[model samples]
Target: MKLLVFAHRLELGGTQINAIDLAAFLRDRRGVDVTVHATEGPALELLRARGLPFIPAPDVRLHPSPARIRALRDTVCRVRPDIIQAWDWWQGLEAYCGVHLPEGVPLVITDMMMHLTRAMPRGVPTTFGFEGLRRQAEAAGWSRTALLPPPVDTEANAPGASDGAALRRRLNVGGDAVLLVSVSRLSEYMKSESIKRTIEVVRELGDTLPLTYLIVGDGAAMPRIRETAGRANAALGREAISLAGAMTDPRPAYAAADIVLGMGGSSLRGLAFGKPVVVTGEAGFARLFSPETAEGFIETGMFGHGAGGADNAALSGPIRALARSPDLRTALGAFGREFVVANHGIEVVGDTLLRVCRAAVGYRPGRVALTADAARTAYFYLRERRFRVASRDAVERG
Candidate 1:
């Protein structure tokens, strides 16, 4: 079957990367012709390198964009796909607006975020990365919902896939020092708080153990991370923590780490690299990945919530225990790598996608329902925009 995939953005985030990787897999391995539709960004290079079919989408400044809808409508007519796979709710709504049932193409929307919004249209096939979210979606009256976690290319991210020694040399980290790394976007929301706390914890730990923390990624929170890292290094009179700017490929950082600190797909990628992972989340949450903690992460998608907000000492204990015991690290790393290969491997997820697509084919919703969804989505977007504007004004006044 021919497939048209809509990626919300061609940026260096988890969802877009997964879309590109899965598209290539379905095309080459599953014998399905797939074309990716997305605006040009860093991840476009990945598509080019993988030799996947692509059509550049118009840059979007607002949701439900007229230009995007027109472009998608034109692309749908040209490609004549059997199914449309949209990466998130916004793209799914755009597809709903652009594609008509007379064409006989069905739509599947995948949302990987921790929370699902009420604004998303109902009666369409949907997938979530977390089981808890999927159950929540079902309780909220969503139909045809499936739990599809992010897939990791185990072969590509496997142990020793990249030059760990070279990365260590570049970071000026000695062989004896325990290296902890986090590969993340470094944004203010859902990321900067834990990262800042990790930097402080690493500095405190450096007083007793030989350790270096390397953070690999850049974004809106870089200035804050830089400032915190600088203070930590100054206090220790040594480079206990270092920041590496974003890289198109982050396998080397994963390979070099004795311990990985991350959440979501990044944590899974670290596990694929045969490293012990300490999952970090918002509100001062941190937990070491082990058999005991595995079930909760599997249900919640590799993140957590802490009762008290943004505590500095949240990560110290777990990280310290891992740093002090090489044997424990090796055992946990082995467990993590095995878990990812069995559960989240790319081929495994590709098969699941094929099943979902087959089930979604040729299914169309009622015209009246579709029209209602469009109206409801428009109202939600308008209210959300107004609230954002008001919040910004309040900040300015303060």
Candidate 2:
């Protein structure tokens, strides 16, 4: 089946990564004809590295432009894809404007990896972010919306048994040290505050537990974060924090840590590594874990809210407790890994999305609802225009 995927930019975030992975997986495994339309960014290079076909889209910023919309529509007319899949909010708007597929062309929207309570309305098919928005979408007359969570490669992120000793030594973490690692773009608001707060919490815990904090990823907030880290070190009476910038692969850092702190994609990566994770922010937040499993590790704390210092008081106890007990950490990590595998592993997510795409292309609202698998096959058959069945070939294949 021919499919077109759209994203605002191909940046180094969860949504872009998921889009790339999905396109590659579909092309390689399912032999689905796939084309990616990226609006902006270096993510296109990554797609090209994997030998994926991509097209550049007209930029559509805060307000829509008629020319840009027409350009996108013309691109869609040329491609005539069976389905148009959007990777995030902006992509959804783009898809809505671009594709005009008879009555069947299905437009499927994905939530990427964050939750936005204010952005998504009810009944709109969604995965993680805000429940209220889901309701709003439904009220707005979107016929089919489903929640498909972000996919992660569980095997690549599994923690290694020997990583702890080796990583601690590499980072110069003492035997009594509690290492806190955050993997996120420094410029992102929540990530910056989380790093700052973690440092403060380490200080509040006193010098009893030697602490080393690692900040990963780079962004507009780098200079500010560095200053904050420096101030935190001085306040804590030691160089307790380090910034490693961004690494293409974050699995090693996740595997090496005592605890992983951050939100959205980073937290998901941490879960895949079986590391205890702490998440912040409301957008796409609900997708972090199944409702039953999210109680302890997930907490609601405002970033950069307090005055005197970071609000480590709220998270300090949990951090210390997780550090002290290997059993607790192991159990929590296992739960997170299991949850991600069941819900967000690539194969599962790919299959789910494939079904959604098929439904969008084959949609006949009044007709009977076929099983997701059957719908996919039918959609493919229709797209390929295979009206004639070969009895001999079918029998031979069977």
Q: By TM-score, who's the top model here?
A: 1
The per-prediction tally of clashing pairs is: 0, 27
> Lowest summed-lDDT stretch of 10 residues in model 1?
389-398
Native-referenced Cα lDDT, model 1: 0.83
Judge candidate 2 against the unseen true structure and give its global Cα lDDT, from 0 to 1: 0.61
Clashing pairs in 1: none
Report lDDT (CA) for all predictions: 0.83, 0.61
Question: What TM-score, to 2 decimals, does candidate 2 have?
Answer: 0.76
Model 2 CA lDDT for position 208: 65
**By how many angstroms RMSD does model 1 differ from the true structure?**
4.1
**Which tens-of-lDDT digit does each residue in 269-290 have in candidate 2?**
7878887776643222212233
**lDDT tens per residue, model 1, 308-383:** 6545566999898998999999999999999999989999988898899889995667788767766776686667
